[model samples]
Target: MATDSASACIRQTERFGAHNYQPLPVVIASGQGAWVLDVEGRRYLDCLAAYSALNFGHRHPALVAAAHAQLDRLTLTSRAFHNDRLGEFMERLATLAGTQMVLPMNTGAEAVESAIKVARTWGYRVKGVPTDRARIIVAANNFHGRTTTIVGFSSDPGARDGFGPFTPGFDTVLYGDAEALAAAITPETVAVLIEPIQGEAGVILPPEGYLAQVRRLTAEHGVLFIADEIQSGLGRTGATFECDNAGVRPDLYLLGKALGGGIVPVSAVVGESSVLGVLRPGEHGSTFGGNPLAAAVGIAVVDLLETGEYQSRARELGAVLGRRLEELVGAGVQSVRVRGMWAGVDIDPDLATGHRVCELLAERGVLAKETHGSTIRLAPPLVITAEEIDWAIDQLREVLAELS
Candidate 1:
């Protein structure tokens, strides 16, 4: 009965919804822990976790409780007036990231956009870059967000083409190449914005010493190092921030995704007062950026991370994941990249595309997504058990064997 209902729902969405995303044929109705139940009443292990927004998993007890408690009291109080929850949220989040200030926003793109504004402003005021000549160095295959200004600097044609009239002041350099990045920097460069791990580029890790080199170069050049940790932060990479794994810290940390605790859209730009303090009262603002509900959820998320249990779990399971995935190389997987509990499995292109592999995995009760062409990313909730991890890997093994 529910499966029939799912077809109707899909048809209705196709009729009314914008054809922006081509989602897999599964109508998820509800989720808990690391699993989601579709409208058809079938369960699927959630491997993507809404791209890490659900890092704590859907309906996490603490986060949901925070949302519910805040809902009963207060929800929205724009930046015009001080909300009770905003101060605590900002303080806690800033402290968690080891920053002195926080600029609350509602989405990942907004956080990135805000960071860009701050960097550009800091350049003119603090770094003394020529007016409107401030340049930000970005990687080649970066996926910051879909905003026009963000996509303007994108190397991926899929995200850049047809979105013309892009904003300037950004230079693209080859990713994971310290030499290229160092060569790209100029006197006008204000910041070097990069992801510690390129999530959208199939969890691409930098060369062993690339991040430390970037840190040194940025500091020596007197340019701000902005780490966009939206997808790679919040215990996703076995640490509070992926930068920790590299033993480097960016001047500005652009954070989101798990910050909202899968309950609300909460994002923030955290940095020292010297950099983030450049913003004046009316310089930058967002109406729905720091609502009470979002603050409550974010505060709860910080509290959860403060325990360090989730980070430990990611490290423990990540080892199991790495061992299992490494075994699959040359069998059906061309290559595998595992960091913490996150993985990017490159399926043999001759056997199937990443999309086809995801479809087969979905049929087998595992949910993942394709990146590039033949790479599929697996980022399940940190709460996932060893048994569940093994199960998902087994499903992938079966899918690849069948296709081969």
Candidate 2:
């Protein structure tokens, strides 16, 4: 519990754990409402927010209460039997998404995998696609999840290398190019899976109308449009869903990250009955997918979003974030792409790498993350205040100034 304990903890982790992730040096011990305390009790603004998993901020009171309440009651009843909480959770989630059915899962990757399975099954059973020939078209630089099948289609070599012999039946297309997508769709194509905003690819935003074009093309071609909203949904992008911003409705929604309110790992594939109804009872399932605890936490999350306050907060504070980041364009910052409360800031390589900038910012009590080399991603919790946003920006400015 001492401040110096962080170094010991880091050393222990490095010694025992896999070296898959290179995290920032700071060791977070506790968090509450957009801020985290280190073992030393140093508080830092949580700009990354667990890659938007903590969109409601760390350990939100409502979510915590729900988790606590569930702990005292039923927790897990596997799919073999029924749990009272699962039906309500699914119904509420389906209603929130305007979908007729919900398939709950434990992680974002599982949700994505479920969507893929549903799409492929629908293709074979409903679309009359020949068996074992169904192909799913994925966008270039898309980051869906890290499972073998998910990473098999990844354009990023870091994610794909040595992970193969990978899953087949996937075709890669240039992202944001409707013409390319159309050309790639063959008679055997089952679905087009993409992220509305490519969160891991430096929060990349597609060209305007790209999503709408995808919807039109998928509808016309009789292919399912799967939107990976794990990172961009749940008020992170100033909307309940990023597809809403583009005025498009994907056939299936792959939702996770924020759905659990940072209390547990919860995800779901929400879609119309016509699409999701393809699965027979024993086709697929998870042990902890819709446990009472996860459902309870997820219900709390849906309740919070029902008020529309979080989305509005993201929109209003996002403007402030945009203005402050835009001002840095010519000052040791190369460029910035901002949508809602999310931003990807490209650092001037002549001055510093995104990792260096993040390190400097962390030293100044603002924690962020770097992606794709020189680009740093900023996604503060919606609960973050205007003053906190300004403060984080000030730290970034200072980091840039010092680097310059």
Candidate 3:
């Protein structure tokens, strides 16, 4: 239950704001590391990490300092005149992603939209696909973003309902099925866009060797394999990219979420010059895309990943998280899937819904969210310690026992 202070804030916001999201009743005031303070002064372990946007945890010192220093100097130049920070930020980010070019944007959805345009344009300019007929293949149940174009390609009805007439020329295929993907490809297919690990679809991991097969199939068909790493990239997956773990490189890397170090909204489509170079000036751009403030924070974020400290933490602590979660499979969890520090635990539907489990976890001072009605995802910040992971899992265990 929410206290008067928290209830007032929730009520005021719901009364005025749009009802697009049904967030838990707790109102957070401040955060540091893996913990947050609610309006009523209660503390909770943040298991969702703002859906992996807070991978570095909240207000990281280096990121905050970088933001402050940038604030004292320059902010935005609207991409009209080149900003000093843009080039360096792009260069470093490209180097980190192992790509030749970076097209900066402000959100994951924009990055997806931008990549779609790039792939389509490349098909026309380089691949010699007939104009306006280029098609991109996407996996079912994918959640790239809420953009109309992105939603149009999504298999989820809730996201697509009443949103379209959606943009056309997208082919849908079953995820983790190489045969379906191969069958979907044609001369008009320009790119294969997929999340390396499906985050919003209950943190689903593809079948073993599935990513490599996608790479192989796309290469044989001369289609660009665009990995939407917006949620699975950075240090959250215990590797710079989830693709890296599979030893398969995609043609384009769509990055966001943690790229801003939880400071600002930063996203980009990273690819070789052959692909991204197809975009001419004024064709696609964002005014606030490569602003100085975002660049400074992005540079700091790259600096952090360069050290590989967070990735190591995620790998080491993720093992601990996976083991604890597996113990509950027979208790109330029907199944569990884990990769690095990310997990999706499917609560037994007969026991309770994922939403109810999350509400109980919140009451016990742990924060988590559900997806697809019955699965709860755990993606605590990479900064979270082993002890904190134990405590959070303990809370879930108790909650399951109570439900049982």
Worst 10 residues of 2 by lDDT: 1-10
Q: Per-residue lDDT for 55 in model 1?
A: 92
What's the lDDT for residue 348 in model 2? 87
RMSDs, each prediction? 1.1, 1.2, 0.6
* Residue 269 of model 1, lDDT score: 96
Model 3 per-residue lDDT at 37 = 98
lDDT tens per residue, model 2, 254-364: 999999998899999999999999999999999999999999999999999999999999999999999999999999888999999999999988898889888889889
TM-score of each: 0.99, 0.99, 0.99
lDDT of 3 by residue, 14-97 (tens): 999999999998999999999999987899999999899999999999999999999999999999999999999999999998
Question: What TM-score would candidate 1 get against the native?
Answer: 0.99
**Candidate 2 segments whose C-alpha is farther than 4 A from its true place:** 1-3
lDDT computed for candidate 2: 0.94
Q: How many clashes (backbone atoms < 3 Å, residues ≥3 apart in a chain or on different chains) does model 3 have?
A: 0
